[model samples]
Target: MNLDEKMLLLATCFLFLPYQIASVGIACILVQAFCRHKLVDAIKNQTGAIFLYSFIGLEFIVTILHSNWTGLGNTWLFVLVGLYGAYYRKSITKNTFEKMCDLVIILSIFAAIYGLYQFNQISIANGRTFLEFHIFNSPKRRITSTFMNANIYAMVIDFVCVMCMYRFVKNDNILCKIGYVIVALFNFFVLYLTGSRTALLPFVLIFPIFLYCVRWKKLFITSIVLELCVCGLVFLKPSLIPRMSDMSTFASRIKIWKTAFICISMYPLFGWGPQTYKKFYP
Candidate 1:
């Protein structure tokens, strides 16, 4: 593999590590881009790059106007990472892309295992049964694994689950298919433990579309039966999915969305300066 590809793999590995180690991975990509003089080309070659930079520029102007300098760092970080993605997408070879996907699935399996362990530990510490443990009991109660939060962890797991499903349908190797199924099931359970209603809801809706697209009749029927069972379980014990059962959390999010809409209307261009949501949310 080339240096860029190797750095990309390194970044993927860093993604599952704790304590904002992913920033180091981002730094690696940025440094490699600088050394290779790929930064400008990365922006210029991509079709959407102009729009991305325009949005960033507008955000910067809004930040200056609002004097929300603290939010500027996040905007810059987002732009840098986005640029790296654009560059990598254009430059990555087919072999490298396949390798990256395989690496992501492998890492996701390990992450899911760690998250399950974290959940078990938390449940034991709380002296509650696994099913009885509420994710929102505290910030630390949810199975974050190596990511910053349960939602992020759930998002990654959701992506990996879809990848696994795709590979399972497409690959001819029996052993590889078995591995994919195992990983998908493991990660799906971990996703459930995450208590990320947003991620779970979308996955539920998208998985059927994937199965339909792949034209897997038997697997699709099996999936339907499994989903029916899951629905039955949820019906019996709504607390299994806390976010669905808890109306208060949903109401809180609704209020936040309403406030965000108001804030957007007030600004109408750019934004309330990145991380200023808390200031205006109330």
Candidate 2:
């Protein structure tokens, strides 16, 4: 197989491994940066690109809660990419980077569709399980779709939907706009199926941000009021309360985060020397 084919196989394998998709994406960015120095320089020159590279740190921080070899590799990849970009700057076209992003979006859509199929139990062997894509397994048959867990599936689709919406907004094509809406609805439905409280927060936050940024103040206020009314209705319906309570991982995550924080505090400057969270995490 060619080098490109080998890399694709490795990426596919990693998708099934116990690592996060976001981490895998960071790794891909690192590989791209090293192999294409011109692309790295272009990224460094772009303000938004710089922000994206900086944003990877937040992923690293959160992934520390479940630090493993994969987690370390992801973090190091992100760090190396940013450092390399900073050290080298040159004028270069961003067409390749944009093409790569388009490919990622296409793959993410497929992942979302696969996740939906998994929820429906329409999967074959030699095919990836939804749980593997999601990054963690859920208890009581969570319908993870193409992910290891429903939450990851929801998160990934949500981001994909957002990117699609961004692209749609920039184009005047009716078909593209319709496709974006369809994809967005599909992602929203999958997220609802996951019943993840954390997944819901982004919708609550981002919808308003988008409306306000687009200068739709009246519509924004109306949307907020409508949401409040819906919440009130749900609050009044006692049966809905139990369903609402079904969507929290706060306790479990708090426990994990606390353990990880303790490890970080203990090691402070150097951390537990990579892949040590499991050894020390409670």
Candidate 3:
């Protein structure tokens, strides 16, 4: 891989680090600045890009006014990298995109394999079922993998599954197609290991869209099949839907969303400064 490819690969990997994605993103920004890269040129001609930066700039100003330094830095990393990507969006060739997708698929497969190891280790150490292996605040055991959180792992696997599905359908190379299938199957297992219902949303939503792209009629049929599969799983493994018996979490989430809306209403323009809600929310 070339320098740009290597940079993207490294950026993707570092993004998994706990509270480190922003720091690495800052380093990326510094590199771009030092290299005299036309960072502004990234979004100069795109109206949507300009609007994006406008919103981000407004948020930055609000954070500064509130003296929310952590929020400012946090927002800076994401917005800066987004704008930078917009600047260089056209530079990423199709070949580069494919290669990056391949790398991502491979990474997900490895992450799933490692998660298997972590899951087994936990089960062995506790001599108990995964249901009893406490993970964070969740009510059940969650395979956190190396991400340190099952929810994050679940979301990552779901995202990877989507990517792999895209390549799986689009690619003609037999070997690559096979690899995508293998990666996708493993992702489902790993996603289940995370015990996250969130994983179901992306697959259920994105798979139909993908099917629509490939064959419109297949979308409906495929969705029905998917729903049946989910029902079948639920029938076979009632434990999979742990939250079905517990509505406390569901209630709390609704309450939290209401509180978030209230907070947003209070700060219509800035919204209590970025990342400050956790500290300030009562």
Q: Pick the candidate with the highest lDDT.
A: 1
Ranking of all predicted structures according to TM-score, beginning with the best and ending with the worst: 1, 3, 2
Worst 10 contiguous positions by lDDT, candidate 3: 133-142
Q: Pick the candidate with the highest TM-score.
A: 1
* Model 2 residue 18 distance off true place after TM-score fit, in angstroms: 8.8
Give the alpha carbon lDDT tens digit for every residue of 1-282 in model 2: 334333433443444334556455546745664576645455556556757765676557756654555666756766655653443334223443333334555666666666567555532333546454332234445556556676676677667666665666565889878877777787676666565656766776676677787778997898788878867887788334223644355677788899888887886765634457668663
Q: Which is better, 1 or 2, measured by TM-score?
A: 1
Give, for candidate 2, the lowest lDDT window spanning 10 residues.
87-96
Quality of model 2 by C-alpha lDDT: 0.59
Q: Any runs in candidate 2 off by more than 4 Å, and if so which?
A: 1-75, 79-105, 122-140, 145-148, 237-243, 247-251
Sum up the clashes in candidate 2.
Answer: 8
Estimate candidate 2's RMSD in Å: 8.0
